[model samples]
Target: MSEPLLLEARGVGKSFPGVRALQDMHIELRRGEVLALVGENGAGKSTLMKLLSGIYTPDEGEFFLDGEPLRATGPRHALELGISIIHQEFNLMPDLTVAQNIFIGREPRTGRVFLGERALEAKAAELIDRLHLPLDPKERVGELTVAKQQMVEIAKALSYEPRVLIMDEPTAALNDAEVRVLHDLIRRFRTPDTGVIYISHRMDELKAITDRITVIRDGRYVDTLDTEGTTMPEVISRMVGREIAAGLGPEGVREDREVVLSVRGLTTKDLLRDVSFELREGEILGFAGLMGAGRTEVARALVGADPVESGTVELRGQPVRITTPAEAAKHRIGYLSEDRKHLGLLLEQDVNANIGLSSIRERFQQWGFVRDRAMRARSREIVDTLRIRTPSVDQTAKFLSGGNQQKVVIGKWLVKDCDILIFDEPTRGIDVGAKEEIYRLLNELAAQGKSIIMISSELPEVLRMSHRVVVMSEGRVTGQLDAAEATQESVMHLATLRPETEAVS
Candidate 1:
């Protein structure tokens, strides 16, 4: 006989003003199995997770645990009742140590009043060691790398020892090695009485770690399939309600094209060294490397978000001095950051306000007054063009899904009419359908004579979207390859080449 259902949601529905976020959503998680839940952005995936985690109560329907009706009052209550959720956006306290963040409210104490730092760290250390995660319990979360911070989040979730664990885009920021470690942990977490609900946009990972797949679209349940019996394209088709076209390879740029941006010997005090590259007009330049390979650093240093100790930047054969982001913007350059929540979008603001931020003074100000009407009109146009799923332009950005939030960031830069655009991990947490849309948009922008620098960790994304690829390693440019020459093997070979090793070769 099959294992009993560990968790089940029956006809669950939720709604907010101006948005029917979810309706008649159903999911089942069997004991000792990892269940994959997938849908396009704004397809009610997040809403369902929130309801299951007790962040939101369903307006209708009910949930059950072990065949018992379950009703949780809040997140804490859910945790107490054997449910823990790790959200895509972190809930960590930057200034606190990993140990403190892991056991914030339930820390061991002396005399029931004084905090016991040593005991807390010891507990965290034991948990980390148990999970085989490479993390220092005493290290400040703010000082850790993004991948390490992700590990801390995992540690915190697993510390709850809940019967049901919900992880949202847990591997979005992780590298291959880190991802392997996570998969191992998930395998170890599986037990006869516990189960996992793994939400992700990555199909390959779903195949590797999940037993069954559940597809939801537009806030409703579609179907569920055994992972091994179904294909990715089939799953995607159901998720988007259409057949997505096959991947399109990048077309090479002409050598005669004008060079729009030139960086020669770009060096930063921290991690970049003598990085040199030229971006041609109407070209999509891809930067690819492993974690800490300085791809992001290059983008940051180029846009003056980070100081360059030694380097020269030239625009159209004319040298330019850019020491701040405002100066970069003045030069008609825009950067879409990888950390959208922290760096790209103003979450508290509405969609219209966030989309018009970059071009506010130029396009929305008249006689020292803000032109709110014109701003909303422009935002509406971009929203429709980008197919951003929101109730209206007046909707708060924080209410939108991760992919839609990313689109808003893109719209802000588009409204600015920047000649040169830098997109860092533009589809980091976005679904496959949204990724295809962004790819098409990038190609269209390049066809419109705009130069783009795309930094991505996904090799397939880089190979598919870049006219030329720049490989980085150990804070230096290891190799540059044209579209025809860039392959996964070639890029990985260059990305792993250390400066000293390259020099010796």
Candidate 2:
């Protein structure tokens, strides 16, 4: 009655130093079905993805494709065999055009020497048309927004036209409207002759996109459920092997005090325009907006990560000029960038070094020399506090999971005793369990009188975390709402405010 399995991994196992990444894992992707791979961060979902994509070979187990033995070769070979993967991180080259990035290796050529630019754009245009995307094929990848970059990634993968397509957190950077387009495309792409592996941590997308759900915990096979029949609580319980608390974070409400950070008429060369808001002591002030709505730009300009043409940053009513991130940090303002991998940590360095980065001079160093003992002690304390999963303080930062890496960034700020902190998409690429931990940490920090400005794309997250919400649209603060007034509907309305009318609710 049902289509036969297109691919299966039997008793697959993989391991890395000091970590049993995966063991005794079984997975199946059936043609005509979207298989959802659900797991917590560090649950070996990534490991399993790598194996299926041919980036990594399983130490144990076998893969069968259409009942034929499939030896794990490599990515190119995998694509040749009708298997393709879109990594969680963007794999696009910034300097190249969208068309060039998509058709890099297989570009149309002129006389076997020059790349046929027109032909390349035409082919990319065909793919873009099919997806109903408004993006220009010849536009440089670096110039596009995060959401557009995500679309380019999908376009590139779909170009391969594989029978088995794998997507890891494809909707992580996309907005609600863009996500709808992606879901529609995925539904259309999944035919009886094709199979799809949908790996994501977004709970709302699980049943909406997938037919069957497979749960993996701690690198082991847990259980599988029909997507329509399973509930969120059931899926989560299986992922963590226990009951997780119901709410996003623990209940620790802080009473608002005097304004800690006040901004007036903040303007940037790109995106942000005349933005003004105030963050109070012991408050979690959330910045909510759609893609390219200037939320991140405001956060960056506040911490001097970007130049502000005209703006006033008043810290505790004291007018301060923040011309650089270092100056901001010196003034007790810490910024956690949304692009954590590229901007947050020194990937080649150890976890301890990153944790002690902000206060290296005063706290972890002395007399123009390094203080290894102090650094190690402080790193251990923060790692323990943040629950960073690593073999030791010396573990490389790049090897840590996305959530752990986020914790390290948080640790950097915490070590500096920063009072004004800005967290931009703090939980992006993070699993649900780790997300709750970050929320708990944020709530705890607020309770401890830390003023926070949190920028998030998810409306539910905005409502769940913030005592007050600031909505931005077209580089302007459209509205501000207290916790009691900031419903999803109200936030959406403000986020989509038009330029002609200024609506501050």
The per-model lDDT (C-alpha) reads 0.88, 0.85
Off by over 4 Å in 2: 1-4, 109-115, 126-136, 244-321, 329-505
Q: Which segments of candidate 1 are over 4 A away from where they belong?
A: 1-4, 109-115, 244-314, 317-321, 329-505
What are the per-residue Cα lDDT tens digits for candidate 1 across 289-310?
7666799999898888999999
Residue 194 Cα positional deviation in candidate 2, in Å, after optimal superposition: 0.6
Best by lDDT: 1
Error of 2 at 330 (Å): 4.4
Give the per-residue lDDT digits (tens) of candidate 2, residues 1-505.
7545799989999988767898999998887899999875578888998888789988999888887877759989898888889998888999999999998899887677755788889999999999787689999999999889998998999899989989998886676788899999998898988989998766667868999999998899999899999887677667657532234322333445788888999999866778888888888999987666788888788878899999798999999998899999999999999999999999999999999988999787788899999889989999999999999999999999999999999999999999988999999988899999999999899989899989997666778898888888768888988877666656655765553356685
Candidate 1 Cα RMSD (Å): 8.9
Model 2 C-alpha RMSD vs. true structure (Å) is 8.4
Per-residue error (Å), model 2, residue 218: 2.6
